[model samples]
Target: MFICPYCARNFYRAPKFRAVSHIRFLNASPNSPAIDVYLNDRLMFRNLLYKYFSDYVTIPSGTYHIKVFPSGNTVNPLIDKSLFIPPEKIFTLAAINEYPNMDLLSIEDVRHPKIPDKAFIRFGHLSPEAPTLNVVLPNGNTLFSNVSYKQITPYIPVDPGTYTIEARSSSSDERILYVPNIRLRGDRFYTIYAVGNLSKPPELQVLIPLDGNSYIGS
Candidate 1:
């Protein structure tokens, strides 16, 4: 004769009630392989290890329905999750937030330049791996390559005066955007800005104003 819900035992000879656990990774799924432990839906423990499945459950104190799955893959099959066992307590779960590699390249604007232009060079990058965009010419000779995130260059023919344009980065956390030294007038009209590795760095703006003043016929 035996009964024990919480010390309601009529045990003629008692000694059998066990439940213990300890899981400390705190942030799972580095690349899941095996994890499944359930009870009351039946199928308790299958390939478990925070480091040794806690020696075969016996969690007695009331309240057990722990489920976790993702363990068997020829391709994929086995996925579920649940946990709550308070009796001789020892459970920890905290880990989820992974996905920040990086990719956001952009350089959109630079169409048909050939008319008194003094400054108009804009390029962008955040990630494309094999990336290179070097355009330097005060008269040292250098024009770059592997470029195609949205390439455009129509007025890089400087020789009217005032110039200092430099956009350089070959990859791995690259960012460039500088403006405030341009005056290579011929037909007149200018704009220069560079910034893109996700955002926030491209603001030297001036779509056409070397200070000649205009509302375009006003």
Candidate 2:
């Protein structure tokens, strides 16, 4: 049995003859127009909003052409790109806008067996206005440094406890964002996303959590 953290849906694997791949779509652009997604010129989703993501879709491993367009109009694609999917891997394709600029980011989601009495966590930098960031603990321990926009870190193990996670600019020690009182549980997996544009009103800076599903393992 496998579960998807994005939608909290469960799935059971069946026997297959060929390799397969899983991919999901995410809209990370704040205040941008809602969009549509297409693969191989076929519409896959419509009206996906900022900070919203879709469930994983499994397909045969191969190369694919992907396109994104504003909702209700397919004549002009905002992004067009080709991607290759290796067998038996999971990936997330994200659409991001830093106002006057729009781009796509592809992230591979990897999972492994949980260590006993410990939790695994990873971080993603999605804030466009922010510089490369350093993820630090309250004790000034750096977990990830020079993490740039659209970048994601590999999972790191830590003991289950309450923590205050902070992000600092790579060029300076000033804290850019701080998330306090995060409670992690043993044997669980989590991904923390740093989202929002620094220039936007309300500043769109936030830490979003996705509790990982343990049934999916490498």
Best TM-score among the predictions, by candidate number: 2
lDDT of 1 by residue, 104-176 (tens): 1112122343444343333222222223555454454654434443343443444556665454454532434
Give the range of the ten consecutive residues with the poorest summed lDDT in model 1: 1-10
Task: Report the Cα lDDT for residue 197, model 2.
Answer: 63
Among all candidates shown, the one with the greatest lDDT: 2
CA-lDDT, candidates in order: 0.33, 0.75
Model 2 off-target regions past 4 Å? Answer: 1-5, 10-15, 207-213
Give the least accurate 10-residue stretch of model 2, judged by summed lDDT. Answer: 1-10
Distance from true position, residue 195, model 1, in Å?
Answer: 14
lDDT of 1: 0.33
TM-score of each: 0.17, 0.85
Error of 2 at 118 (Å): 1.9
